[model samples]
Target chain A: MIPAPVIAAFHPPRRTLLGPGPSDVSPQVLAAQSKPIIGHLDPLFVGMMDEVKALLQYAFQTRNEMTLAISAPGSAGMEACFVNLVEPGEKVIVCRNGVFGDRMRQNVERCGGIAVTVDHAWGEPVDPAAVAAALAAHPDARFLAFVHAETSTGALSDAKALCALAKQHQCLSIVDAVTSLGGVELRVDEWGIDAIYSGSQKCLSCVPGLAPVSFSAAAVAKIKQRKTPVQSWFLDQSLVMSYWSGGAKRAYHHTAPVNALYALHEALRMLANEGLEQAWARHKAMHLLLRNGLDALGVQFVVAEPYRLPQLNTVYIPPGIDDVAVRSRLLQQYNLEIGAGLGDFAGKAWRIGLMGYGARQENIALCLHALQQELSVVI
Target chain B: MIPAPVIAAFHPPRRTLLGPGPSDVSPQVLAAQSKPIIGHLDPLFVGMMDEVKALLQYAFQTRNEMTLAISAPGSAGMEACFVNLVEPGEKVIVCRNGVFGDRMRQNVERCGGIAVTVDHAWGEPVDPAAVAAALAAHPDARFLAFVHAETSTGALSDAKALCALAKQHQCLSIVDAVTSLGGVELRVDEWGIDAIYSGSQKCLSCVPGLAPVSFSAAAVAKIKQRKTPVQSWFLDQSLVMSYWSGGAKRAYHHTAPVNALYALHEALRMLANEGLEQAWARHKAMHLLLRNGLDALGVQFVVAEPYRLPQLNTVYIPPGIDDVAVRSRLLQQYNLEIGAGLGDFAGKAWRIGLMGYGARQENIALCLHALQQELSVVI
Candidate 1:
């Protein structure tokens, strides 16, 4: 028998989260998560789930009945959209500009579907003309997949134009709104996105576990007409729909994450109270404040202004600045947390976030001041 | 433009959770979950994750370095074990006695493996002799899968004996200890369990959504030598290991459920403080007290005494008693929650759980008194 190891109680530091995702969670949401545990099939909990779905629809600006939360993280939600929509031997036009787009390609390949890539620069939005060309070249492509707001590069692609192009080519669109939903202008119904997925921790400011997802009628019909069963049982949307659908009696899927759902409900409720458009405006306003301050510190953004995401701001590290040392000092002295660059831009860029509850004037001021202090010491 | 829907704040009712799973969580664990949200890749959070791994290792009674918590629920953990270990066209002997065992067959087939069944009666332990016979008949079997504690039927199988039989047949064993890990005796290393998965909501008294899993070196070797990639990308263990392994620089596999991990750390730490054997004894003693009180109320158990699990107790519904009415009344009047029968035994039995923090003398007394009062009203 293995002996028990001595461990201390985990007291997390009070951090001002300015990361790409998992931004500051509100106290109301955290307290909601601490509510007493209940059974997954409890009647009262089911009622709360219904409210969560309605709130998610409000956030995504869609009236689709199939909108609900997946019981895993955003990556699982991304996989759920691809594996359910694309069948074996089918072609999918996947636009690749940042990390999540490449992840979509991996999902397509794993599901035995061929991914036809439309490549662009890392910090640039996906080009609608290139996507149209790919769809034109591959007429048999059944789906088009792209990230609306790329978390890795802070680039905001034109989801509306891309979805329009997919519709023109008789293809369904799957949008990754992991960093876009509730932080920017996203109208799933207006943009004609057939399927989409977003994370709870990103713009929702909920404890990070659940992934909110939605599907239009076209996507549901495709799932129903699939020739083979989905390769994943846990991620099968058909089975999951029966459990989340409104009814007096719901069939049991896997056990729902009870407390996590509570947190999401509270988070979405707070968002609805604040209003989605107002939340977007707040993010943009905070971004401008941070931007002006960073510009004074000689920090230049990687993405061009028009295409940059207001929630996630990727900026180049100042020349001769020690990335590790400055970040460590900021964390140690100022209790500030900022994101490091991901993928190809590692050590060259830093991602500063103004998402959900983190998009406040106070948080922005502290982040800027902390960076100034840390840079002064390092340089 | 879509208008934001007005939603009320979610205020969950106080419930005394005594269900099949998601037993009553402790206040400490709940408060731990309410701690300020931190970045998943934060150095401090990484240090806490290391402690969580160590605590899980102590609870699982194994020194397997691959032990860590999955970012999703227990069903995902089950899928992870099967998808990672069983390759396409491989043969697995699945011992089916209850719901989770059938779920195992589904997971195996979804992973492109053939499941050869070794059937036993529900509410009874898995027949080790039958597993041996199946393994002997199918010499090409690569794995044996079964549940250590069947939550659906309240049956406790002999995990040590089952693992021994699998080892004798030169096959790896995948054990589901979801309801058994903290409440009973589980020596994974000594029992030779190759791969095991459990949930946080069961005997650990943690909130739902996280799954703790451990894999022996032999299981790791099998996954390493697999010919085909695992079908589910989110459930892949090899990619997850790099993030959970002890190191200064951990790869980013996925953004973990940060607050949920905090709850698990606290739950496991409580278990360590109480000592595993002491916990097992407490569960057994509480079960006996509940059994006597239930007997006075003329309740009959579904599973026989020897094979019955202490955490989950399945009892036959009294003649002329309405299952739904009684359970609904208990929840409405007493704020108590118990589980209804699932699958084959629906409406015929009630599952009364005495797991973790709920396995107390006071809870047992309250459950007995509440049931007696409700039965009197119904009759």
Candidate 2:
């Protein structure tokens, strides 16, 4: 009954979404975005959900029994993983090298778990030695939390080494692979990661909304034996499991965003066809292209070569140049979008993402030319 | 890059989305849904955000300075309202008439607030006199929380009377108008409601991923003076406001669901064209038509006429009838979706939603015919 208003559509100049995450969506994914929304539990939608889960498993390299998409964005995925796995009064060893790691600490604390933080410099990955030392120090720790790829600083951590450290201390490991899953090599099972969560954006190239999460058999058992009920009834795995895992007769949680799921399924299907290793290699190759361009323009990377993520490249701002103004000009003039540094490096660094569909050589060339023009004004 | 899949051009089915919500999206809104994704802070997107705020103000009948859509769903909106308003040790009077009200109570408790509940029968509206009495008894209560419309039971509460009572007692009112919004007449300013939240589904007829929320100046002041920090950094209104409010420069909160906002903007535009009063009348008339059809069959309404919501209609299931079987038949054969009764009313009731585009005459005829065919054996 709503009368149609003559509100005009506000179309931004077609910019490459080359940010830390939510990279440029493929035309097919964008078309999937317009699919008719069906009921969350509609048989057709449920079929789509099953396919999404299967594709997510392929990307994460995990055979975990509890693999599904959280209804909210990546942040809620972090909350769900921590709140469901970390019980009240439990001690959690959280490794913090960047913003996402700090987010993990916040999640653990909000869940009433005492956070034992192992702090690292912003651009550095979580050192396995430091994580092992922290695990040894906190003998009563129930979980070890770390980010696999630090989106804020483009640092890629050694997830396998950290998981091994947690295993040595008899602690379940929770991994935040929000910016990792498809762009990098992540073998959840081989690395002994008990719990992991990822975003649909970033290398997955899906529009941002759902969070793909997985829990190993050990983590599910821990949830099963929890002494008290989870505070967040909405995000509780036990309740969510009935809806996500049970076939045919799924319980109602919240209304799933049916169209978004269709898009995610399409994006994941695209990933499946690309082959996980091939996708990872493609991302790395694209990163090299971007790196070469930036280096040619005298822009050095913030993170060293060996540790940096291929998708998210953090670079220090040149001395005396206004970061915001340069980014603004690039956006307004050339229709290019890049990321500003987060937290401590806020005014000092710029993050250029060569991710997913935005990772094409054409986009890299376009960005280089645009940045060169925009930076000439300030530099 | 995502591998190209064979993407069929989107031509959504013209079904009546009449279950709980995502009530028939209009063609205009569907077209809006396909608009290209833009950066969350793109100037054009920011301008669109302004229009969205203005439209929301019209829909909620408010002039509150803090009004914006949460990037997540209705549940997240519920969480935001609680996390920001009800700090630990605060006392909140929660009126529980149905499922969503119970959910509010859960949020309050999880936020470490003391929830003093005013109970009502599932199919009945909340008693304003009871709420007044509770407010009088708990004079120290900081807020009164209640649902304006109970979607699960198809009941409409006296939101104006309840808000008046809360104001008289010098307490803030946190209202859940998720189901009532657009379908029911709500005057946020006239009712003196301090804080209110709504969903994108229901009468809005958009998708389900966004929640529109608003806060009065008084409510904003209360939040500004809170002693303890909000537990959820993400949902904290203070943080979200910097991005949502049209300040000089928007602070980054999280990536806004770009294309989804386009769909919501289009829905609001439609609402703006159709005066709110006219829209309300349309919903009422549609409900009347649906009632006539239901009466022609052997079905009886679970919620009585006086308190019934025109948008959601709960009907009693006859004895010996298989509720699941009938719902399955409706979905499989008719491709028509209706809601199963929630909580204690499960298997006892079927909720038929006459909302937005789903409230048309053809939809009513289709729904009635489908129900008649399925219920003939049981009745």
Alpha-carbon local distance difference test for all models: 0.92, 0.85
Q: Tell me the tens digit of each residue's lDDT in model 1 across A164-271.
A: 999999999999999999999999999999999999999899889889999999999999999988888889999999899947688887889999999999999999
Top candidate (lDDT): 1
TM-score of chain B of 1: 0.99
Model 2 lDDT tens row, B185-231: 89899999999988888799887888999999999999999998777
Q: After superposing the true interface residues, what Cα RMSD does each candidate give? A: 0.9, 4.8
Chain A only TM-scores, each candidate in turn: 0.99, 0.97
* lDDT for each residue of candidate 2 in A129-246, tens digit (9 for 90 to 100): 8888788788999899999999999999999899998999999999999999888888989999999998877888888888899999999999999997676756878988998888
Candidate 2, which segments miss by more than 4 Å at Cα?
A1-6, A375-379, B1-14, B319-321, B375-379
Candidate 1's displacement at residue A325, Å, is: 0.6
